[model samples]
Target: MESETYHGYNIWGHAIQQHEEPHRPGPYAASGTITQNNRVIEASGVLGFFDTDEGAQQAGLEWARAWIDSHG
Candidate 1:
């Protein structure tokens, strides 16, 4: 999980590990959440999957930033 503040709102990026087969790690799921004053503003379901956890997290962050930009 990673977090940052954007436009006075708190944004979070998460990477959820997945399993594709027995004893094998699958891609990471990207998700994000946005909050203001500790109150939930928006939360996204899985945005997509990526090969690396960092990639997924960055995708989530990018999605969150775009959301904020469009919504503002």
Candidate 2:
């Protein structure tokens, strides 16, 4: 998946992505990332294999929001 900016955060990928490399291999893979001010502050860390990019991105958004709330 392509990196997308969501709510001031960058939702990065779902496996298949070079940076969020697949933990194992196969299909239905995914990942997520959170960025602020153009800097990656949080990431899924491990590639979360999902059936769809939407799911991955959604998770990422949720994570980013939670982090921001807790940290801020």
Candidate 3:
């Protein structure tokens, strides 16, 4: 996971590798979260799955930026 602070909002990239799940074994999914006042305000689930960690992270970051632009 990676995190960044922008405009007082904390954005996080959640990229987890699925090790045992039959549906997505050995792959990663991109999700995003937003935190304000040290609490999570928005969290995403399974935005998309990717073949590489970098791809997942990029998706998460892009999603987060768009969300922040609309919500912040």
Candidate 4:
């Protein structure tokens, strides 16, 4: 938790919420593209994911699996 290195990804999605709590930081990543009939929110973050593009895509897909449970 002590480092100057910032790790993350540059993706796109649709943001649903512009509201922010007072003195509360907004989400590290906001929805860039809301797919799945708006049921799925694609918020992007590093999460210390894969190093390569292919790996990151796979990582994103894997992380997306959780949305099924939340939306289902």
The CA lDDT at 50 in model 1 is 79
lDDT of 3: 0.83
The lDDT for every candidate, in the order shown, is: 0.88, 0.58, 0.83, 0.35
Across 1-72, the per-residue lDDT of candidate 3 in tens digits comes to 888887788888878887767787448989989888989888888888888888887788778889889975
Tens-place lDDT digits, model 4, residues 16-67: 2323456424332232222443343455454332224344444444444444
Backbone clash pairs for candidate 2 read: 14-30, 14-31
Deviation in Å, model 3, residue 9 alpha carbon: 0.5
Question: Ranking by lDDT, best first?
Answer: 1, 3, 2, 4
* Candidate 1: residue 46 lDDT (0-100): 93
Q: How close is candidate 1 to the true structure, as a TM-score?
A: 0.88
| Least accurate 10 contiguous residues by lDDT in model 4 | 1-10
**Higher-ranked by TM-score: 3 or 4:** 3
Candidate 3 local Cα displacement, residue 47, angstroms:
0.7
On lDDT, the stronger of 1 and 4 is 1
Better of 2 and 3 by lDDT: 3
Question: Per-prediction count of colliding residue pairs?
Answer: 0, 2, 0, 7
- In angstroms, the error of model 2 at 49 is 2.9
Cα deviation of 34 in candidate 3 (Å)? Answer: 0.4
Among all candidates shown, the one with the greatest TM-score:
1
Give me the displacement of residue 39 in model 3, in angstroms. Answer: 0.6
Off by over 4 Å in 1: 22-26
lDDT of 4 at 63: 46
Looking at model 3, the pairs that clash are none
